[model samples]
Target: MGIVVVEICDSNFLLSLNIEEIIESKYPEVAVLFNDCLGFCGLCRLKPYAMVNGKRIHGKTPEECLEKIKEAIEAELAFYA
Candidate 1:
């Protein structure tokens, strides 16, 4: 099994959601990195977003973003799994 890397900027955590916690709890072999900065300040501060497999994924709402992030992870995991 390979580890999936999820990069999240440490700018603003939208809607008080714990992204790292969610990812850790959902995926088995995964690395959730609360990176210092992913160089996306506007996106990070505005809405809920994450970088899965180096791809930016964002959502209108926190819940939606969480689900999308999970979906992105699953999609990436599919390739490696």
Candidate 2:
């Protein structure tokens, strides 16, 4: 019913994949924000990750992380439905 906030670190390797475009195009109600730092310690440097509705979702690879992010978003949307 409301916007789903997906926050990613600006320095995250996932950015190189144009994740913002991919996610926003797929989910109109989702907002993908690339912040300077997500304050997850140094985890951003080690893996692909995103904060979906304040929940941390990460994966070994960027592609995997993107899929998990979508799944997390879908799960959140289901509650509204």
Best by lDDT: 2
Candidate 2 local lDDT, residue 22: 97
How far residue 31's Cα lies from its native spot in candidate 1, in Å, is 0.8
Q: Write the per-residue lDDT of candidate 2 for residues 1-81, one digit (tens) a residue.
A: 237999999878788688988998999899988799989989999998999999999999999999999999999888888
lDDT of 1 by residue, 1-81 (tens): 336788887775643787777778878777888777889868788887888878888888888988888888888878885
- In order, candidate lDDTs are 0.78, 0.90
Query: What TM-score would candidate 1 get against the native?
Result: 0.85
Worst 10 residues of 1 by lDDT: 12-21
Each candidate: how many clashes? 0, 0
